[model samples]
Target: MLQSYNFALSVVLLNVIGPSLSNCSVNMALGMWQKLQIFLAFVQSCSNPFDIVCPHKSHVQFRTQVHCNSTRPQYMCLYDENKKQYTEVCVEEAETQREGYNTILRGGIDGVPCSTNNYQPFSHSSNTGGSCAIVKTSCNDEGQLLYDDGSSTTDRSCRCDYRVGYDYVTVPSNKCFCKPAIEDCSCYMKYCDVNQVLTQDYKCARVYKLTGIFDCPEVSGLGSKDIEKNKKMPSNATKTGIFFVQIDYYQNKDKTYHGILDLILGIAIGMIIASVVLLSTADILNVVRLKYSHNDVIHIVCNHVETVVLCSIELKCHLESTRHCKFIYWTKRINGDISTITSRTPGIHGSTVTYPSLTLDSPLIEDCGEYVCCAVYDYGRVCSPPIRLTVTGDVPSFSVDNELHNTDIGKPVSLFCKIYANPPCSNVVWKKYEDGQYTTIHSDSIDCSQTKYFTFTLNLDTFMESDSGYYFCYATNIVGTSKSKCITLSERKYAPTIEVDVDDNYCFNKINEDVSMPYTVSANPPCTSVVWKKKGDGTSTTIYSEKIASSPSKHITRSFKLVNLKEKQSGEYFCVATNEVGTTKSQSVLLYVAEAEDDDFSSDENRSTVTTLPHRRTRYHSCPSNWETDYYPIKRRSRLLS
Candidate 1:
């Protein structure tokens, strides 16, 4: 026979072929060793009963109680929620023998009855006392089972029991909301119930459920039972409320496998997109290179770029993405290809670019010409087409060196003129103004270097006051002409050579004596005039006058005579000479004249006269007179007189 109960509240086992069934007493006892082993395993797996159990009444009560005085024994109990209480069965209890009023319920889910057959006679109610009365009512709402009241008068009788079959006299009430009892009333609920096993729907009924995470168990068939002949069992066990709840094993396995596949697929898709983008960008760059040619930027315009700001034009290369490129060099092919690179940021295009714009520094006429620009990506030297830039006006440039000063009087002056030209000047001329005529001292054509720069010298040895104005060294070529700033020439001042001389008697004479002295003054550059002065008083009293000729080749000479000599007039004397260029003076000289000596006379001729004819004759004959003669004395006197 099959049996059924709630999985959480009661567990019914249909022993189809176990050898333990017997036909004697209502208690079916197990061997001591077997009983102890089952009890110990169950106790180890069960949670605390007090927290989980609830007590309630249900028809056909099945309960167990074990008390041992000789040994300390442990027992296992399970909660029966369908029966609304805890159910404990002793493993060592012996099974009952009579089959008078017993019916077994067999099925697998909650709320379904098991098959009832072969015990229909126990279903009749006789109101008589017999063993058949034990099957008086099926477990229903009226015949309720409860725990004993906690009092001395409380009923302790075991009204229901399970094993082979100790029948019950009353039906048990089944309720869902009863709380677990305290103290002796402690109970718990289980998963299965008796009605679920007896109903025919139990065989095919499906249990519906929903969960937080997806999982499903493998389906299996239910136990088969007949409801018509089944009678209620006396014992009531806990119902099997809702069991089989744990982690969602089935869904966890599927999610883990799905996640791994998604990651691999995502990586593959990313790699493919990156490769396509790189290839497309490379092809576009290649197409731009083939479109432009080198001969494009070599063009000529009539006038150079002039005006403060004219229309802005651009010189562009067709290459835009110059990520690997270096400088863009520009050259004027028509104008001898003078080259320069823009020191500014250029405009960028798709695969092309424009240079720093074709603008003027201050808009000059010299810039009106042709130009070219090239792009250098690396050491590889990539070149672009020449760009034709037409500046409107001519570029005027003044060539000059620093200002020159302190030149020698008779030396030549050479100033350098340097100019940078856009179209190459015609010629450079160095000139000076003389006699109101512009005389070109030096001239040269700039066609040699094409840059207007040359050296020129002006012979200024004969430079005079009239030549001391602004002298211009002008540069003029085919492109344009510019003059160096007017360099000023000034005449240098210099003193002339001066010579001075005094007459033979320059000393002062005695008072009232006629003393005469003469002096001369002279100079080169032909002294324009001359004058004399006395050193005692700086008064320039002119004693001589003369006019001189031109400098370096002419000179002048003048003389002055002083006719009066006096003690007071004896002092230093000097002369001054002047020329057209400057003046000069001589150093002073001092003069003094002494008085004449007085004569002394006596009565020497009154004494006597001695005659000597012989001495006289001898004196005529070129002989000396004798010593003994008075003629000798006379001769001596004559000698003294001669």
Candidate 2:
């Protein structure tokens, strides 16, 4: 009867919990244990005084207390075929006794919350051959209770934001988001609204899921204002979203800025007005100065230091409305060279020497030195400051019209030698070559300051053949000496005037023995020298040199004594006179020497005949063209009849 009662009890508990079980495959195994509390609650409500209460059932309360006190065992059991249905003993041993505890093993469906009429509390399984699981339920004001399947710890209370491709969302909870296919859609505040339209299940890998719902506020001016929020979208993106932005407003200006602008305009206008006034006033003042003032000094500017020859230093005067003036006489002093500045020579120092009412040309300073050009005006003499002249030797300068040419011989020729030097020079000399020799003629040094081009003509009289060759004029000062190329003069040919007739005895003597005669001849302007040569042989000798007389025609004589003479010397004697200027030869003179007569022959053969004298031959030589007439012609003697 106890076994039959236990079987009936299992069947009843199974029936109570069967319907409450969830559809989960694991919950089916819960059987009657799933709804034990609900069944008990029903039992208490249905009990009558006349019904029989099982003794085992009365221990349900005590057994429940004991099960609660023991640590729940985590184990699984299966049928062991070798030991045919492992004994119920193992199950009884695992269980502990509790006062009024009653449990039966069975299979049954678990009771659900909706069917429990809200009377059920917390419960575990109460059926035999089934495992017990805990089920908890919560209730609402409608007296309805909702039960958890007891399989999971989570609830359906939370919701996530839904979005599609490339959605922007925050991390962790991932509450904020931006709409997909949009540019610059990063969340600035909360959730972006357009982002919610996308599907949530379609999320990207390595991307945070929007697990929270957030609302975005409406931006009033975005896409609504005249200006577009964005221009271009990224290549992969389709649209750009406008975001809420905060901005501060400002405006400013001041009175100082307006005042400055006014000041600038006033200054500009004043300047324009001042310019017009000054223009008219300056014209009138200039006229007044030109008419009333004599000290209207004008400045001059020079340009082109080298290669600048004749340049006009322009002269100008400011002509007031009342006055007019003309250029007067002008002069310039350049490095001691004096010259009148005129239009012929327009300018010298690259430009004209300019002055008020007096503009004049300038002179050239051939060398580097200090030069000044003094202008003489109608009022007075106004001198310019010493202008330093530094001329490059790249283009050398020459003093114009300062040389003399076309000179005559024997007469003095003066070469005007001038040069441009800074400080005045005193010493001047004339240098020349004369008779294969050099001669320097000195002149008295003279002061030269007032002249711009200091020059002196050299006087070279008493000239000789050597002196006639080439003449040079040199001028020197403290600075240096300047040399001019030689001015050539050919020696003039003139008849040699016989000024000397020495050796009169030699001129009129008869030649009888071997004799040597030595003589001299002199002439003017001055004889270079005297020479003698044998008529037949080319032998010649020098007799006199560089000898001269006071006057060109004065007679100066030289004497020659002969010791021995031969037939060659006895033939004819003549004298020649010559000078570097010219030469003249004297007429040939015939000299007679008695020849020894042939002696008569004495007796023949007995005594040797003796000759009385040796025979002598006579010869004659003519004088050359270097001397005057110094000999008489020979007169033939008449033969005596014997």
Candidate 3:
């Protein structure tokens, strides 16, 4: 088959085929050798267990995937969900997949299966069309990963698994209830199970979930003795805490209770009839909030480059309140002790009990840990929820060369991903993106393989029209993945090449004699036409013309003879091969048509000796298909036409 570029996968096969094409002949055996080699390799790579393989979204640029494995050897593989099997697609086929067709699944992507707990089966777009994709999944704060076995297409879902000690409750359960597993248990039944036991008071008791953090102290009412003292002296009354749960009565009952209760009831009744107000407010307030400044994420991951993080501390208070207060920062290193970052009293920019922002700035590696916000007041101190600030590294940033690449078919080309990242990128790989989706260009190896040139590169030994498109590099670290700007690239195709079998050779014969010249060519897309030209006196003249038949193998050699050679027929002759890529001419050979006969050389100054090669075959009809051969050269002076 002709070396057609498939848009599905941008594969570079010429590095392997380009060198081999040089030795093959465009004769009857055309490209048999190269074809056989390609077929065998393709069969070996895609034989079994591999399903549908997708090609690069755009092939204006292409690259080869590292060999997969011995059994299912391929650049990338896809599992057919419905078929429940892996279908092998050889590396070549994977690179040159057809565009706008062929659905490529991402189950067995990057030459391997997606991470069980990390990646979920997803779909993406290709060439502006929808196709299968493999994406990563994440869980939220109140979620738990109950099960994950690494399914490429199935996303692991978070389950609700509530725990007692680890969880919290706003109100402690003073009373506990039981829901029996017995199907016949009555919903209205308030009795304990048969295995349950009652307390000393003949009451059933059970443990309840622990309260979240801490609870405020309960209020205690005044003692009976104190109430009696107050009642004895009607004018000596003082405020005392009261609680409804602590009411006491009988025997030494204080008559003051009756008087107070009657008075309170009278006031409550009058209030319901518009004697009192229904609104209340508290003035004491202390609120604290902490977060990183805009785009500052040293609080996320460590970075090799110099970095900074502004921990913005927000204190909520009333407006117009300017209470100068001390602002303190703290740092807790990983697996280390917490240390205070001393600070001076910040000139309060707003009113006390008002919202004001306090900021702490630093790039210290020790600034990675949980944080607490505290707002001190005359009455007390209030603290906010803890926040963990990690400074492991910053998200990576990089750039691409975006240089233009121009080349013809059967030629080699290379592209590089010149990028700069902080904390250095843990992994960098090429990817083809189209229609809001990206296709990985390499199989992640042990830590992922690195392409050479500028540290990361994509080399295409050879590609076709389909191998033209946009490509870019993707970098990743512990922080996250970063995408570089895409570059538009194209690999121009060219025509086949023609060359003379022997260089600087001349064919001489007397006028009216016949001369046979051999011309050899190596072409792709099979040269559609051939022409013979003789360059004489500053101009080129076509001496022979013929249409060449297309062939799978166009590396050919042909011999054409000029009968009854005339003086004008003598010149430099060369062969031209034309294909879709372009046209190329072979090396020129000198052709001399002389007026003197063989015997006229005996005339003194112009006389020359005639030497014959006894082992050599006769000339005039000698034409060999092979261009790469061992042929001795003869000097033009005193050399006979052979």
Best by lDDT: 3
| C-alpha lDDT score of every prediction, in listed order | 0.35, 0.35, 0.40
Our tally of clashes for model 3 stands at 44
lDDT of 2 by residue, 159-232 (tens): 12222122233332322322111222222112323212222332321111322222432111101111111222
- Alpha-carbon runs more than 4 Å astray in model 2: 1-415, 418-442, 452-455, 459-471, 474-483, 488-517, 521-583, 594-642
TM-score of 1: 0.28
Residue 434, model 2, lDDT: 73
Per-residue accuracy of model 1 over 528-612 as CA lDDT, tens digit each: 6665566545454433444544445444443343333345545666667777677877766455533432211122342122223
Q: Model 1 Cα displacement at 475 (Å)?
A: 0.7
TM-score (all chains, Cα) for each model: 0.28, 0.22, 0.28
